[model samples]
Structure formats: C-alpha cells, structure tokens
Target chain A: MPRTRIPVVAGWFTEDTAEEGFRLLGTRCSGCRSVHFPREDDHCRNPGCPGGELEEVALSKRGTVWSCTDGRYRPPPPYVSDPAVPWVPYTLVAVELAAERMVVLGQAAPGVGVGDLPVGSVVEVVPGVLEEDPAADTVHTTWHWRPVAVEALS
Target chain B: MSGDVAVLGAGMHPWGKWGRSFVSYGRAAARAALDDAGIGWPEVGSVVGAQTVRGGYPGYVAGATFARALGWQGARVTSVYAACASGAQAINTARAQILAGMADVVLVVGADAAPKGFFAPAGGDRPDDPDWLRFRVLGATNPAYFGLYARRRMALYGDSPDDFALVKVKNAAAGALNAYARYRTPVTAEEVAASAVVADPLRLLDICATSDGAAALVLCGMDFARRRGVADPVRIRAVSTVTPTFPRTVLDLPDIGTDSAVAVEPSPESFRASIARSAYEEAGIGPEDLSLAEVYDLSTALELEWYEDIGLCGPGEGAKLVREGVTALGGRIPVNASGGLASFGEAVPAQAIAQVCELTWQLRGQAGDRQVPGARVGITANQGLFGHGSAVVAVR
Candidate 1:
C-alpha cells in the first residue's frame, strides 16, 4: 500500500520541493508587524497591542546560523527514530530570521559535518526526512537548513 | 485586592511508576484533601483540572476525569493545559472563582501518567512543530537543554559538576524523608558522578524522572474558611501567572529558537525572574521574608538557576548557596523543601500543584522530616513549556 508521506501541518511552507527547498510560512500582523510561525490565526500576541488583521507571510528563505549542536543519543518515543539502525549523530542548527525576528531551528543538511559551520554563518531552508519506520511502514518527512556554499572572501 | 483565598487542604498521591491510571491517583488525592479539609465532595462548588499529555493526546482532564471517577455532583468543571505549570494555573483558576463568589469552595486537581524515559513530542510528520523539529532534526531531548543550562552555568558562574551533584545529594536525602517522593535513597557525589551521562555535563541523576502522580487542593473564600472553622489557615496570598515581557532572549522549552535581540534590548529581568517578582509584588513580601521555597528543580543545575531567578541569591551565587548548605533543610530560606522534582520526578500537570502542596504542608508545620524549622512563609515557582510561568506565595 502506497501511503502519501506529508507534512502533518498545513500551509506552513511554500511547498515541498524535490530538492527539498521550501520557505516556512508564518503570519504577520499588519498593525504591529509581529510574525507568527504555524501562523497564529487569532489576534496579535504582542500583548495589549491594537488589533491587527493577520496576513500570511512567507518568511525569509535564508538566515544566519545562530547556534548548532547535535544529540549523541536517542530521544524518547513519539519522535520516530529507528531503534534498529544504529544512531547516527546529526547536526542541529538555529537560524536567525531578520524579518520574523525570531530564531528557527532545523537539522543541518546532509554532509554538513560538525565544525563545518559556526555561529553567524548563513544557511538556507532545505527539505529533509524525519524517519522511515520499517515496522509501521511510513516515511516521515521534515525540513533542514543547508550552508549557502558562499565563496571564501579573503 | 490583597484579600486572598485560604488553602484549606492540600494532598498528593506519591510519585512513581505504579502502572495505574491517572484517574485513580487524582481521586485518591482529592479524597485525601477533602478529608483534611473536613468537607464533603458534594459541597464543592467547582472543580478545575490541570491537563496532562498522554499517548499523544491531551492528558486526561483532571477535573472531568477525576470528577467522573468520584461521580460528578454537578460542580462547575474547567480543564487547563499549560505543560508543567498546569496545576498552579488550575489553583489560580479556582482562586479566581472563590474570590469572585462564583464558588465558595473549589477543588483543584492535576495528575499525570508519564511514559518512562526522556519526554518527547507527539508522533507525526510535524515539521512545523518546534518541539518535534528539535527532536527529529537534532535529537535534542529535554536533557540536552539541561546540559546547555548546566554548561552555561559552569562557564558563567563556574558551577562544577560536583556542585550540580550536591543538589541531588541534598534533594535525595530530603526525599528519603518524604514518603511521597519517588527516589527516597540519599545520593552521593560519587554516585552522581558514576551515573550514566544522558547529556554532556549532566548525569542521569542530575535530571528529574517522569513518573505517575497526582495532587489536589481545597480552596475557599476567606469568609467561607472562617465559617468552616478553619481559622488562620495557610492563605494563598498571591498567584503570579505572568508572561514574559518583550524581547524574551532565553531559549525556553518546546521552542526551537529564541527571540533575536537585534531589534530591541532584552529586559533586565528575565521572564523566569519576573514570575517570582510578580508573586512577591502581589503578596507584599520579599524573598527575605520567606522561610522556605519550592523551586522547579527539573535538573540539578536548573535548581541553581532557580536560586538566582527567584532572587534567593545572585545569578552566579546559586552553586555557592548550595555548597554553603544555604538551600537545604535547616539552611537559610531552605529551597526545594519538598525534595522538588529531583525527588518526585515530573508528573507534568500535577507538579505545580504538588509544589504548593509542599508549601501548604510546610506552612502548617506538618511536613514530618522535611519540614523547615518554624516554617512560616513559603514560595513555589515553576515554568511550563510554551511560555507559561507560575509562582505562588503562601503564608501562615
């Protein structure tokens, strides 16, 4: 049985790309101009601020690497990691979005080894797989951030 | 509006993996509280439940679920979900009802049946969820954040792992005296060092466990308490349920990233600090007036953070206070006098209520061995996932 592997949330990004590139979508208040990811359908969360209609805003596609670290151990269940295939250390990065004014986290792109990127480096949004559970027969999908491959400017 | 509600009674079902339903735990706690208050269940005018997350669903609603288990008697019911701070919010909700004269007597309950091991986000292909993103992408479990905080403390305040281990040593010894705690055996620095490292810089004993537990409180208006002949009860003078102010810079739980300080300068007082500050302001008391405190010691190092955040000491003075035996029982303003999460593990919805339950017992001088001498005023502080912060001030 072929099951459609999909992002559990709706309207959170531009669209899933074959190259796995998509801009995460959020909402911005027209009045105070506060941004919300997963899009706050309600009023602005900027406390006691004047009411403003929320508009869907595609966030900046790239951001500076804020911080990065990786887990050397398996997290508890509900985060679908394969118990069989030995744990592979993966890098995690926090990206700073200028427009959204918040830091967003995602997995580093494949082959982006530890120590390759440092804080303040620029990275861009790219798609990634969450997990492939052989027992339940599903391939969970997610997003990642890859280094922009900028030329070294002396 | 300094006139506050009275905490007539408080109770808890001991925390551990008993493999029973959360409803049973809640009902037992509720009954114990009613017995302590000398009140009948039918006279309770309202009930508020602190919700839990179970099997990827919202945790069984403590109000309706436990009410159902006890046979609902037409009490107004409310359920609150705020991750760890749910219980305190439930008590806050009940206090509001009592103060409003909407209900003279209200029952507040929170309970949880937690899974064994590191807590994780719900199951799904949820890329947009920050919690799931942290787990799937980084495999950053709760311990990783604890490790980050511990390491940051070490770097900033020169807190050693041995200093962090002392928290467990103190708390476990206190837990050994507490019948309601999960791990009652006193721990040693050697044992903490020998324990498996879940995250770099934080050992297994450094982190609190996830266990099944329940807590409940009986609250009533001042007039109602007097009428019930419960004079001079432990009064809940203030409940500070404040949100972080603008430019919250610290990375909190269930969030992938932090608010960038590029636009505006971060506040001088962090959100965690503000939670206790608001409580002090509402109670018209200062940290100096407190005889004991119940802080969220989710990790041994995190306890040290609370020492600073709660203003028991300065930012870098937490480890020093612990090393000086200033936070243990018989110490000045003894912290985590209920043994805290270090002893009890975490029961999510039940914890904040449990924190107050400890304060209530201590204020009444009924906490057997873990009691602070002449305990008069106590403060309980906790933070929940997704920007929820809570603290309660109780005075005899």
Candidate 2:
C-alpha cells in the first residue's frame, strides 16, 4: 500500500499531476494585483487600495537565489523531526520571484548543501517530503528550492 | 522643532544568564534609575514597561508589575511589546505621555529572563500564527537568517570571514571595558574563528546568545528637569517606533516571504534604513552629527548592514567601514560602544533600553573606560520581529 501523502500546510501548492505542475501557491489581489504566499484568501493586504477579491494563483517556479544557509543543530520542536535518529542538516534558500518582486524562503532540495548553490544562482520549486511518520505510515509534504544548472541560467 | 524629553537618569541590571525573575531585574534597574536621578518612586507620575514573552502574566502587564514591585502609588501605567523593539516603544510611549503633558515624570523599564538555546515560538498548534508556521515548516532558526545575510554580504561586497571576525574583535574590545557587559573578556579573531558553527557561513560567536537582563530610564519634561536642579541633561531628541511601509521587500524574521511589490513600488530605502531616516528627520540632526552609535548586533554581519541602514555609509560599503576601523572605539562614528548584543547577549525587551542606557552614560561622559571622548550625540538603532522599526536619537 502507498503511504499517505499530506501537505504540511494545505493549499500552498499545486496538486494535479500535470507536467510543470509543481508550483508554490499564492494569492493575487484582483483590485491592486498584490500577491501573498501561504495563500491569503480572506482579504487583500494592500493598504492603499480599498479592498479586492483575492484569487488563488500559482507562483513562478524559477527564480534567482537571494540567499541561503543550513541549520547545524536540531531545532526545537513543532518542527517534526524524530529524536531517535541523528539530525541531518538541511539547507534553506531564499528565492526572489521576479514577477511578484518578493523573496520567498524554503528548504533546499534534499542532498543540496550550501556549497552546491551561490547567491544569484537560479533555482526552481519542487515537491518534497517535510517529514515521515513511520508508525502512522504518513509523509508530510512541503515545497523545496532546487538549484538549477549553471548552463540553464541563460 | 520636535520637542525633546530630558533623560534624567539611566540604569541597568548587568546582562547575564542570572537565574532570577523578570520582576527582580526590572525593579532593580528601576530603583537604580530613580536613585541616579535623585528622585523617589513617589515623584514618578507614570510608568512604562517593555513587555517580555518569557515572563508569565506580570510580564505582559509589565508597567503595573514594576509599579507593584516598586510599591504602587497609583501611577498611570503602560506596557508595550514590539518584539525586540519593546523597549524603544516603551520609551516612545513615555515620551509621548510626557510631551502630551499627561505626566511630569515617567519611568521606562524593560527586562527579560530568556530560555536556553534557540528562541522558539510560543507553544501551540495554531496554524494561523506565522511565527509557528515558519519554524515548524522550515526549521529556519534565527541564525539561519543571519547566515543568509552574511553570505549575501560576502557575495555582494567581497566580505570575507576574516572581515566578519574583525567585528567580533572590535565589539569584544569595547565590551571588555564595560563593567556591565556579560562577556567582559576581549576576544580575538582567532577565538571567533575557532568558535563552533551554529549556522552555515556564521559561527557561534557571530550570533548573540539569549540572556536574562533588565534596563530602565527616568524621563521627564525639560521643565521638570530644570525644576529638579538638573539642567542640560541628556535629552531624547527622537524616539522612532515606525512600522514598515507597504510592499516591504526585505525578508525579516517570523515571516516566510516578503510583501509583493506588484501592486506598489517598493520603498527606495529598506525597512531598516527607514527606521534611522525617520529618527534623523525628527531629531534635526544628520548621521554626520553622531559621535557614537549603539546598534543591535544580533550577528556580526548585521552590524555592518546597520552602517548603511543608519547612513554611516552607502550600501555595500559596510565592510569597507569596518575594515578601516571607522566604527571601532575612538574611530569615526563609533558603533556599538556598549559592547552590543555580541557581549550582552539578548534580553529581548531590555536590549533596546540597554542601548539607551549606554548612550546616556556616553553622552554624560560617565561611561568610565568605554567612554566616547566629548560625546554629544548618540543614536540607538534596533529592529524587532514583524514590522517594528526602532531607533532613538539622543543629545547632550
């Protein structure tokens, strides 16, 4: 039997199995065109514009790396890592989306260390498992930033 | 000209991991400030406190807490929390009260007893809280963000680890002369280099630790100061507790993404720079008038970033300023002469107040060994989590 796949947070990404479907979900304001990640469905955040309908939209998958780092120690809980296993350090990358003109932070793809990417390097969003519960046979899913090849930048 | 609030006195309980309650530290600092001002608790017409999350119920209502601890006398009370900028907001609130004629003399205090290791979000399964979501989803610790800034600086400004180490050396040297600093021993570049890595591209020494500490100040109108035989006291010329402008492009703490700039153009000045600009405009003085500065140095690289944010230099020129020792003690526009968070660690609410306390000492020429000679103007710059931007300009 296939393990259950659960998003760490719901409605943050695309679910369909279409090619190029892996995208971080964000909300765009109908009146002002302001975009918000983690999908703001309730109200438009633009203070100047009166108010507008927020429409869920897929964010650009590729962007240049604004900055990146890795956690060297186990983070305090609420972050679901098993204490029984040795902590595997994970790299975090902040990617700047050109269309939105915002920098989005996410974990780097598994096995991608700080040395693998540099500031201004292009990176794309990919679906990845955030954590796995062995007893429950469930996998918590999340979005990751993967560095694109140097040749792919041009 | 914007009115000024005279800083009659400033005090602090030395910053350290002392196993004590927040009330004790706050009361001690408050008493010290009152004593230094030659005033008693009965003379204080109002009290403002910088709230801390670590302390239970009393921490939230810190003004009343400090009042009750200092023996309540029906003083008007206010408590404020702007994350790390709580102290600045408290000062701003007290200044507003005094300037509004609501109080003749107001006491401002901020204190915190922090937990060990990484500062985590308050416990719960609240999905709506952005702070909790970031930690749970990404495990992005504070140092991780610091590392990102450090790496970006290196890439953009050709700053090396050696340059970052020099910041620690400079701050530690200043801290060594500060009797109130927790880590009074001067550190070398080798010591900073040998420290364990807590985040990639950033070592343990590069980041500040969590500490239990407190700070307080006695603020009064210029009239009150003169009536009390105190003339020409250190005056708080500006207390900037401004919020971020819309379409904030920077990635600040407790947030997963920046505000989208599609709807509106981003500000020409970053949020951090805006904090200082507002303070400078209000103070009627430019960065050139500053004799010294006390900026929040959560990380060595962040201090360099502040050089540009506070208009000490152009963008990306921060590393060059540090390399030239221009921000070191006895140098041009010395930064963090109080030893900074690097030596004091973080006491959350107290940290910003501590910065002002250091300014008070320097401006009064009473800073003992860490004194900036003939210091007249000083500025304290700090940014808290969320949209809070804090900076205070003081002059003798």
Candidate 3:
C-alpha cells in the first residue's frame, strides 16, 4: 500500500493530482494585484495601496531559473533530515515567475544538481516528498522545482 | 553633517572563540574605549549597547549588563539588535543622544559569544517567522544565499572562480597585518581553491565563520571633543539607516520569496547600493572622495558586489576592480582594510562598530601597516536581517 501523503505546510501548495497537477499556492491582493508566495493571507504588502484583502491564489507553475546552488554540509536544525543516515547534498533553486514578476525559492527535484541547470533555464514546480516518518508510515510532501526542456516552457 | 559626533575613542576585545561570556567582552571593550578616551565611567552620561541574542537574558538588556559590570553610574541606557547591523544602530543611538543634548559623552558597545557551526534560527515550531521557515522548509543556510549570489555573479558578469579566490587572497593579506583579526595569516588563491565547497561556487574559506568578539566606541559632541583637549578627531559625518523600498526584487536572507513587482516598479538601485548612497548623499561626498571602505564581506563574492554597490566601480565591474588591484592596500580605494568579516568572522553585534573602529584608526593615521596613505574619508556598509540598513561615513 502507498504511504499516506501530507503537506509539510498546509495551504502553501495544491494537493497532488493527475488532472490539476501540483502548483505552489500564493495570495494576490485584489486592490493592487500584488502577488506573495508562502501565502500572505492577512493584508497586501504594497505600501501605496490602502490595505486590500489578500485572497488565495495559485502561483505560476513554470518559471525561469533566477539562480541555483547546492548545500554540501548538513544544515543545522530546524531542517529535519535523518541524522542516523549520512547527509545527501541538495540543490536549491530560485525561480523567477514571469507572470507574477517575483522569484520563489524551493528545493530542486532529487538528482537535480547545480550543474544541471543554467541561470536562465526554465523550471516547473511539482509535488514531491520532503521527508518520510518511517515509524509512522507517513510522508511529508512539499513543492520541488525541476528544469524543463529548452522548448517546453519558453 | 550638521550634528557630527567625535569618535573620541574606539576599542575591541579581539576576534576569536575566547570561551568567555559576552558581558565580559562588552565590559572589556567599554573599559578599553574609556581608557583610550581618558574618560572615566562617571564621565559617561549615557550608554547604548548592541544586543547579542546568543548571550541569553543579559545579552538582551546589554546596556544594563555592561553598566552593571562597570559599576552602576545611573547612565541612561539603550539596547538595540539589528542582527549584523546591531553595532551601527548602537552608535547611531549614542550619536542621537549626544546631538539631543541628552548626554555629553556616550559609550557605545556591541559584543557577541556565538555558537560554533552554522548560525541557526531560534528553536521552535512556529512557521510565522521567515528565518525559521527557510531552514525548516528548504534547509537554506546563509551560505546557500551567498552561493546563489556568487553563482548569479558568475553568470551575469563572467566572473570566474579565480576572481572569487583573489578576494580572499586580498582580504587575507590585509587581515594578516591587523592584530585584532581572527585569521591573521594571509591566504593564497590556491589555498582558497583547495578548500572544500560549503555551498556551490563558494568554498569553505570564502564564507565567514561565527566568532566571539566585542567592539566599543566613545562618541561625544564636537564641542566636548575640543573641551577635552583633543585638537583633531574622527567625526561621523553621516549614518544611513534606511530601509528597502517597496517591490524589493532581490532575494534577501531569511526570506522565501522576493517582493512582487507586479503593482509597482522596483528601485533601479538595489538595496545594498541605496545603503551607501544614502550615506554619501548625507555627507555631501561621493565614491570618488573615499580614502577607504570597510564593507561586510560575508562571502568573498559579496565583497566584490559591495564594490559596485558602494559605487567604487560600475555594476558588473567589481571583478575588474579586484583584478586591477584598485581595491587592495596601496590602491586608489582600499576596501576592508581592517580585514573585514573575511578575517574577523562575524561577531554579529560587534562587527559594524569594529568597522567604524578601523575607519577611526585609518583616518587618524594610527593604523600601523594597513593604513591607507593620507586617508581622510572612510565609509562602512552593512545590511542585516529584516531590512535593517547600515552605513557610516566618517572623516578626519
């Protein structure tokens, strides 16, 4: 049987599904149309506009790579990795969403290293398992960015 | 420029893992500054301390802690925390008080006893804080951000690993000349290239380490300086503590995303550039007038970035400046002449004040070997967590 899937943080991304696909969630201010990732549900961050109600919005699934790097050493907590197991280096990607005109940071898909993508390469967000709590048979899910083919998202 | 304050004295407790309490370092630095100024504890009417979160309760109320350690003198007290920018805020606070006539002579101090290894956010499960969320969610350490910036520079400006290594080489050479620097030995380009990669494009030697250190300054109104029989003193001409404007496009530390520029146009000048610009504008001096600069070199590549931000060179021209030795000692604009965080690591609260101390020395021509010849004007630039801005323009 497949393990139960859980979002590491709720309301930050869409539930994984074949038809709709996984998309990182954000909020758009109705008044100024400003976009915010990690979901700013409280108020619009725009200084000029009178406070507007922030509504739930889905962020652009595809974006161009703004920059990328890898962490070689084990990061200090609250980053949770199985300390019992040897550390595995992970790639971090900052992607620029053209529609939103903002950049969002996420862990690159497994096997995606810094060498795999250039600064302006296009990438797509997808659902992935952040970690597995083997004792509980549950997997924490999160969004990951994967580089796409040159012609795919251009 | 109207209400200039005299840097009557400056001191530091060195930079290293001393295994002592932050209070001790703060008191020692305070005493050193007082001694250098030839002023007693009682003569100081006010004290402002930069906060060190790692130092526990006393660190939070650092002003009282240092005062109590020095014996209570009923001095007005203030404590400020701006992550790495803490010391600048403390100095600004003292300068404000002196200008307001709240105090004739004020003692400003910042010290920290940092934990070993990567600087982590305070422990908790709350997701509200961006600093905590970044580590918990993406495992993005400070070096990760540095790596992104370095890689971006490499892509944008055709900067090579050789250019990055040269920065360490230059700073290490300068640090070797300073007695207070933690890393006193010069580093070679080959050594930097040989170091293990902490974050891609940035080697272990490229990033600064967490250090335990303290720095203090004695600041007073210009009248007080002359009244105290000091003929000439280093005067703080401007303190730029401006915040980032809306639609901040660049990704900053402890943030998950950049502010969207959909509604408004982003500032043409990056936040870092604005920091130095504010100081230069206030001081009525531009980059051409700078004798030396002490910028936060959290990473080797970041130092080069600062060269452009401070307008010493045009954007993407920082590497050329480094390559041409224009930013090295005996050059036209010597940067990080006191060794910088590249040598001092990061004492958090203390580092910015330490930058000022180096400026005071260089401007006063007291800096023994690393002094810039005929140094007259200096600027120190720093940016801390949560949009804290810092820059100090000092003149002899």
Candidate 4:
C-alpha cells in the first residue's frame, strides 16, 4: 500500500504544490491586524488590541533570507531522523516576508545547503516531506524554503 | 540606593558534571552561603529556590526541597521557574521579601543536574507547545539559533570567525584562574578554530555545555546589615526582570517566528538591550560606571553580542571592542571576568545566580586571581525563554 500523506502539524501549511496554492498559513488579528505564524487561533496577541477574532491568512510565498545556518550534528528527539542511516546535515533558513514584516523559520529544500543561500537572497515556500515513517506507512509533510531562481526574478 | 538590598553572602558548588543529585549541590551551596553570612540556616527568615525541571518532582518545589534538605525550621519558602533566568528571579523574590519587611534575611538557592548534550524539550506529542514544535518541525537546537545570530552578525556587521574565537580565548584565560569553573584550561583562538563545527558559524568550543552545579546567595535589607554591625557591604541595587515589549522583532530561542512589526513599531532597543537598560535605570547607573560585568556567554559570538546589548559599546562595535582588547581583563570594561558560561557551561537554574555571585565577589574584592582591581560596581545580564528577562546590578 502507498504511504499516507499528512502534515507534521495540521493547518500550518497547505499540501498544495502549485505556486498559488503552496504557502505557509498564519492568523491575522481582525482588531489589531497583527500577524502570527503557526496560526494563533485563540486570540489576538497584541496587548494593546481589545479582543478580536483571529482569521487564518496565507503568508507570502516568497521572502528574502534573513539568515541561514546548517545543523552539522543531529538534534535529539522528538526531532525525527532514522538512527540507522548516516546523518545528513540540513540547512535552516529564517526568511523575512516583506508584506507581513515578520520572519519565519523553515528547513531548506533537499539538496539546498548554506552555500546556496546568502542573507537577503529571495526564497519561496514549497511542499516537502518532514520525515517518512515506514512502520506507520505515513509520510509526514512539512514546508521547505527554496532559493528563487534568477530567471524567476525577471 | 534607598531600595538597595545588602548581599551578605554568596557561594557556589563548582560547576561540573558531578553526577550528583541537584538537592545535594543546593544544600552544600546553601550551607556555604550561611557560613559566609556568619549565620545558621535557622536564622534565615525565608528561602527561595530556582526550579530545575530535569530533577523531577523535587525540582519543582525546590524551595521546600532545599529547606527540607537543610532540616526545615518553617521559613517562608518560594519556588520560581523562568528557564535560564530562574536564578535571577529567585534573587528578586528574596529581595522583594527583604524590602517588603516580610523577612529580615533571605536565602536564595538554585541548582541543576543537566543531561550531557543538546538540551531537549520535555517529551510527548503535544503540538500546542512552541518549544516542542520547534524541535519537531525544524530540529532547531539551541546552537542552531546561536549559529543564526553569529551569521547575522557576520552578514550585517562584518564580524569574522576570528573575532568570535577571540572571545573564547579571553574568557578561557580568566576561567583558568578560577577554581569554580568547569573548564579551567586557557584556550587559544587557534584551538577554537580547530574545534568541530556543531552548527555552521559556531564550533563546539563556541557553545556552552550542560553540567550539574549550584549557587546560593544570602540577602538582607541595608538597615538589617547596619544593625548587624556591618557598616558597609556589597549591595544589590537593581534586579531587572522586564519582559519584551510588543512587536518583538528579534528571533529568540524556541520560536519559529518573530512577532510581526506591521501593527506596532518595533522598539528601537532590542529585547536584550532592554534587559540591561531596565537594570541601569533602576540602579541609577550607566554602562560607564560598570567596573566589570558577567553577561551570559552561551556562545562565544553571543558574548560579543552582549557587549553591545549591555551598552559596553555602540551597536556593531562589539567586534571592534574585542579586537582592541577593550573588554579584556584590565581593559576599559572587562566582561565575563569569571569566564562566563564558556568556563562554567550552563546549570540553567544555577547559572544566573552564579553571575550575581561573581558580581558580589568582585564588588567585595574577594575574587582571588580574576578580580578586577578596585572593582566597585558590576552588572550581570541574562535572558530566559518565554519572555523572562534577567539582569542584576551590584555595587559596593
């Protein structure tokens, strides 16, 4: 049987791979208009704002790299990685969304390394697999940041 | 000065992976503090214990645990948990009691028995927790954030790997002279460069380790000190525990995103700079008055960041300060004179109190070899997860 596809955390990002469909989800406050990544469903976090409804909003698909680094050593659990296989380092990037004026962190897409992304380089959100659990027959889905191609700029 | 609380005694169980229970280390540190104060445990009007999450149940009710370990005489007990800022919160609690006249003398204690590597969040499949989510989603370890900050500095201010290594070299030299430090050998820049990279832009030597350790302080009102026939003593003039204001733009630990600045204007001063600013405001002193400082150096690059955060120098000038040896021993304003977390590693609850302990010793001229000559004023600054700010200003 084929593996089931599920978000590592539900409602954080759309599984849609198309350019218009693939984007990280966040909540914007109706009262204060403050934006929160990871979707604050409870209430507006802005202290000054009188209580308001938080509505899910799709974050900007493209952003500039605020900073980037690679994890050389394996992080301890509950960060899932197979212990049997040799550890492959992953690049993590903090991307700045101009429209929202906020920074969001996500793993770089597979085959992407620190050498590829410089600070202020443009990147876009894409669907990626967080981990695959063979025993569970499930592929945990997550978002990955990929550098925007130079041709895409024009 | 009128709100000053006298620091009668300070003590620590030398930081290391001692393979001992947190209670034992806390008791030993408490006893040493009581002895230094020339008083018995029974005389302490109150006790405050910084919570250690790793020690299980006893770590939660640390105040009662330490008091019970010392054979409780029914002292007012309080336990505070603020991540890395636990120790400072414990001290602040003690100071509040003394200033409020609820207690004549208070004993503050913090201890921890940390695991060997990468500090992990509590286990379980809770998606509600941000700390757990960060690890589960991105595998963003503590050092990874340090690496991001280091790289940011490199990109923004042109700081180099060599500048980061020099921070370790200066701190290790001071740590070598102190008996309480875990790593007592002086380090060189070359040694730091040679160390394996745990996170890109940050090497193994650049980051701190986790260890078992404890620190304690005996505090009382200035009037109480005077009544006890001590005309003058080291005084804790300020204990700043300010939370970050709205629109926190900086990406701090355990968070996958920064607060949006679209609605609110980000504060001109970053959260870290605000931590020290609050302390300076309360203490009525500027950075110029500081003879020495003990800032949290979780990473060698972090030490440089702190130089600017604590107002030791202007923004983007931390690399210049270190390069010119301005923050080194016998320089304009020595930082981490007791070697910081670079030498002591991290004991979570115990670390912030340990910073204050260093300040007390320096203010009293009791620090043996690493003492800053004629040191009269010192500041300790640290930050905790979940919006806990920690800084203490001590003066003689």
Off by over 4 Å in 3: A151-154
| lDDT by residue (tens digit), candidate 2, A1-154 | 9789899999998764453579999999989999998788888777996678899998998999998999999999789898889989999999999998899999999999998879988899998989988799998989989988878766
lDDT of 1 by residue, A4-121 (tens): 5666355766654655447777787776777775477786666644778989987788887765655557776555666877977666666778767787767777778436656677
lDDT of 4 at B117: 98
lDDT of 3 by residue, B1-396 (tens): 567999999999989999999999989999999998999999999999999775268878989999999999899999998888889999999999999999999999999898998999887787888998999899999999999999999999999889999899999999999999999999999999999999999999999999999999999999999999997899999999989999999999988899999999998999999999999998999999999999999999999999999999889999998899999998889999998898999999999999999999999999999989999999999998889979999998
Two-chain DockQ for each candidate model? 0.27, 0.83, 0.90, 0.87
Q: What TM-score fits each model?
A: 0.84, 0.98, 0.98, 0.99
Candidate 2: regions farther than 4 A off: A16-19, A151-154
In model 1, the runs with Cα more than 4 Å from the true position are A1-70, A91-102, A106-154, B55-60, B124-129
Query: Candidate 4: where are CA atoms >4 Å away?
Result: A17-20
Q: Write the per-residue lDDT of candidate 4 for residues B1-396, one digit (tens) a residue.
A: 779999888889999999989999999999988888887888999999999776368889999999999996999999999999999999999999998999999999999988999999987787898989999999999999999999999999999999999999999999998888999999999999999998889999999999889999999999988998878899999999999998988898989999998888998999999999999999999999999999999998989999999998888999999899988888888999999999999999999999999998898888898889999999999987888879999999
Chain A TM-score compared with the true chain A, each model in order: 0.84, 0.95, 0.94, 0.95
**Candidate 1: deviation at residue B154, Å?**
2.7
Give one digit per residue, the lDDT tens place, for model 2 in B171-259. Answer: 99999998778899989999999999888889999999999999999999999999999989999999888888888888889889989
Better of 3 and 4 by DockQ: 3
CA shift of B82, model 2, Å? 0.4
